[model samples]
Target: MAEAIFWVSFAFVFYTFAGYPLLLMVWRRLARKPVKRGFWQPSVSIVIAAHNEAMHIETKIRNCLELDYPCHKLEIILSLDGSTDGTEEIARQFESAMVRVIPSLVHEGKAAALNRGVAAANNKVVVFCDARQRIHPHALRQLITNFSDSTVGAVSGELILVETESSDDDTSAPMGLYWRYEKWMRGMESDIHSTAGATGALYAIRRELFRPLPEDTILDDVLVPMRIVMERKRVIFDPRALAYDKVACCAEIEFRRKVRTLSGNYQLLVQAPELLLPWRNPIFVQFVSHKLARLLTPYFLGALFVSNCFLLRGFYLIPFALQFAWYALALAGWLAPERQQGQLASRTAMVGKSREFS
Candidate 1:
């Protein structure tokens, strides 16, 4: 019984951290192909849902205005959801004939706010971006370029964590480290098949493919792209198009964000059961590696510890020793929280941060 449990635990970790990445590399190599270019420019509506984002609204609007796409071909839609502050007023200042502001009397969550923006959008493609994030000058052009392929239903841009100009030595330590690893993983996933989820910070989809999400939906980003996948269209990730955003001010704030995300992940599993079944999805490799492995991480970790505890007898000591080493590392992370800024420390911090945010 102990041996069985040990093997099972080992397999879970091995598959998640090692096996999955190797599979992605092989798949990506086999799937590599050159992209065809054309003059398939489609009208795009860029939507931003602002909830008390007064400080960033002006800059975000300016960024949208500066996009490389044709002015007549692009429409900017900013939605202020229940802003008691100057969020609406700030947004209004940026509103020109090209930029429109949709104000909600009461604050609805992000999903509802985005839905309102979608209704007001007058374009063939709708691009969703966070009010707090800044897009590269060519982001919209790069994203829209993918639509040249009719099979591409959605396109997600790379999320780049911008380091604050003022850093007290460890300033880029947290956000920089986290995003680097995330970018690496995303690149691997993009090479293999469709990415599991789109970065909510910057993603675009065909306006015809827009679906209204539940009002309380926590992960609008995941749901939007998953909906496109459900329609049998590929959701491609374009690294060339990037969105930059600041990291949370503190670990606690970051934790709350992660908790909400993790809860949404759970909700996704309940909402999309077919994604869990390998036989039903041809891109089973993506579903299992990107989503399932993440959802099962906590449970897998616990099972490993418990199984190791029971394997104290002969030869079981090896796995038990390894388990202890992992725990020691976790403990060290807790003790010297500042160490969490480095690459290894940041990855550990991210796991803890996710749990706290959830």
Candidate 2:
């Protein structure tokens, strides 16, 4: 019984993260259809919300200006959300006739900033980009191509982890691995239906479908695109359109980001319970495998530990031993100073910290 339970839990985790994604990929490949680019060019409003982002705001503006889109048709809107540093000042320096700057006195979160930016938008399409992320020259074009299909209400670009030129040690292995898996899963999900979520780093939606997110919202990227999905409009992933950003060099920094994201995801689940309901959403399998599984991972880990402890007195030595071995591996991963191990440790620490903080 103990062995069966162990396998069942293991299978659950595996299927949720890996098996389902693979199945989706296969399904997509079998029923794939080509999308043709139409001669339609819509005015695009590029909205960027910046808060204490002086380090990369200039680069972001330069990249946006250099994008391969019609100069007159593309408008850049930068919202400086109560930035104390030189963020607002630097952004204002780039304020030409094409770029508009919205300065706020209060430091609202990204969601509020984006809401304000979207309201100021006068284009048919709104593309949200992070101040830190650098987009490919043709990313906007690739995203606009998907708009050729009326069913596609939102389109997210592929995020590539830009290899830091300073590091020859391949210190970004864990992040690289995660991005590869994410890209694969997204491609598969796009093939069958809409992707489970979108990255705030680079995603575009029709201006008409824009909805103001709650002020306390953390994952505006996911919430915005999921809103489009709820409206029965397809949210697509375009791998050809790429945005690149350096993976966080500090594991602690990355862990904090992930914890905040997870907390926001929990909040989203509460706000949009219908999205998780199988009967309400026909593509329940994607939601369960992609989003729900991530939310339940900590609980699953706790359950596994408790079950192992409970079965220690029974005739389950082998299963208990296996559990110990698996935990030993995880511990080893935590102890090692290598990037991969550090990242694993950061995730584990986040689970513990989130529980404590909650």
Best candidate per lDDT, number?
A: 2
Tens-digit per-residue lDDT, 5-45, candidate 2: 65667677677776887788777888664454566789999
What lDDT score belongs to each candidate, Candidate 1 first?
0.80, 0.82
Please list all clashing residue pairs in model 1, or write none if there are none.
255-356, 255-357, 256-357, 258-358, 259-357, 259-358
Could you report the Cα RMSD, in angstroms, for every candidate shown? 4.9, 5.0
In Å, residue 118's CA in model 1 sits off its true spot by 0.8
How do the predictions measure up, each by TM-score? 0.87, 0.86
Give the per-residue lDDT digits (tens) of candidate 1, residues 1-358: 8668768877888888778877777867888543444467888899999887767889999989999999988899998788766888888887887999999989888889999999999999999999888899988889888889888888899887665543323445765676676667767765555677899989999999998888888888888887787777777889999898765544544556778888998888777777777766656677777777877877877887888798798888887888799899878766775644444544665787456434
Give the clashing pairs for model 2: none
